[model samples]
Target: MAMIELPDDKPVRHPEYVYMDYARHLSGRLRRTITGPMWHGPSLREALDGINAADAVERPIRSMQTIWEIVLHVTARAERARLRMDGLALDEPTPEEDWPRIPIPCTAAAWEYSQAQMATAYRSMAVRVCEVMSSGFLKVVEKQSYNIATMSDGVAEHGAYHAGQIVLLRKEIHSRRPNGAHVTDLLW
Candidate 1:
């Protein structure tokens, strides 16, 4: 099939690309930080693995959340926003409300299962977003109720904030290890 070329005079819109860019940056940073066995660093898979290993007791500490929780929260937020970006609604009729907490697994097996589910959700959002980018459906600025600039800024800022938190969490976890003798072990 012959490819059709549009006029170069007008700028093309691509909100999905905009969002995809933010996701790429966010995911990259997460993957690179948290490191170990099932808990290796520098990738999304490893980050989640490390997060899952977090102790049940150490998981929910006020502003300091377990890694799994953080991943779930980000995934849930992204999924909800993506749905709205695609012109979808929440299941059933309720007032526009907060994003629901994704139920996580209590035991190891359940934790892995929940992690897989969370991964699926995150991957789904990535796929949908990429699809929107390639299909050009996200090209129009009006297609986004919040527009590309606002959406992009929100994603960037939120991702960075959470990423910073994860880094702090990892440092705290590492510091508490049995052989974790030195203060510099985590700091420097």
Candidate 2:
């Protein structure tokens, strides 16, 4: 067969609408999948397993959030969203505003407790996604502050972005571990 070389396309048109829908759908699923106990290892526990406690405490790859901080931050965000969605006034201030006020615990037991709380919060957020889908996609609820999102697209993107940070942090931690074996581990 003769090889044919095609010239580059004159210009690529952006499928902005299609891409937006895809982003909305994909983010929804990513949020749901990561919160569940799936075999593909998307759950919070799965993400936490095999990770050293000390390493997980280190700050995120790009953000100031440590893995522990990220867990707490995500949980708080979910809670705030739920409140706003439910027509409740958020007595709790925004994270950036309240972080200094909301003292982070320093003990091991406290860290574990916070992670568990986050897991519960994430599961609740997933349930809310189902509620919204059942009601209708992008149904504007007066309670939702007119700050609406399609099911979970907005929060999901935020979560997934942080999740990637978590994954990178894990790799860095493994590399720095005493064995330094994961520095060369195939799974890494």
Candidate 3:
């Protein structure tokens, strides 16, 4: 079969080549930053690994956000990005929405649940990215200036940024403990 020719006179390879390359790059980023093995440092999951509900809600550093709030905030951003990529409408995050409030008495189970929810949200967004790429819908949407690829990169970077914060918070929390235990020791 004759290959498709672009305006630049370059013969197009299989559609899979174009789509798969984009999909793999985006998904790999999501995986590495959110849950997969990290080359640079701990993945998001690792950063939050052993945080109990108490530690998650503790503000050891004055005026800084708790791990619980950060987790929810990150999850919300990932979900919103996925919605945008799906061509769905999304409202701007209100101040209250950006940094979520933890329950009055955050329990271990509640923290665990939030972590699970964040994982699910991240996975959902990654899957949507791959779907968009595989379907060859790579052009910028009419409603937005950036394309799905750009959004994917933003999500990965956003997650990584918050992951670093969680790691720092975990260290601070552990340091405040009498036992001086490491964060990894608390992992379930």
Best of the candidates, TM-score? 3
Model 1, CA-based lDDT: 0.48
The collision pairs in model 2 are none
Compute the lDDT of residue 39 as modeled in candidate 2: 41
39-146: candidate 3 lDDT, tens digit per residue: 676788989887888888788888788899999998888888888887775667798877777866688778888898888888888788878885545767446677
Can you give the TM-score per candidate against the true fold?
A: 0.55, 0.62, 0.84
Computed on alpha carbons, the lDDT of every model, listed in order, comes to 0.48, 0.57, 0.80
Give the clashing residue pairs of candidate 1, or none: 13-139, 31-42, 31-43, 32-42, 35-40, 35-41, 36-39, 36-40
How badly does each model clash, as a count of residue pairs? Answer: 8, 0, 0
- The true-structure Cα RMSD of candidate 2 reads 10.3
Candidate 2, residues 1-188, lDDT tens digits: the string is 22334476444434444444554454456455456434433455556656555656775356566777677776777666665556565555655743422235466776677767766666666566555443443546443434435435555555666666666677676766678745223342
The runs of at least 3 residues in candidate 2 whose Cα sits more than 4 Å from the true structure, single-residue gaps closed, are: 1-33, 36-44, 60-63, 89-105, 132-151, 183-188
Error of 1 at 92 (Å): 15
For candidate 1, lDDT tens digit of each residue in 1-188?
A: 22334686555546555656655553433333222111222333443334444442264346665665666565565556567547564453232233334355456776576556645654555455444543443343343455433443354345445555665666566667788734433422
Residue 173, model 2: Cα distance from true site in angstroms: 1.5
Q: Give the TM-score of candidate 2.
A: 0.62
Candidates ranked by TM-score, best first? 3, 2, 1
Q: Once superposed on the true structure, which residue ranges of model 1 sit more than 4 Å away at CA?
A: 1-43, 53-61, 89-105, 134-145, 148-160, 181-188
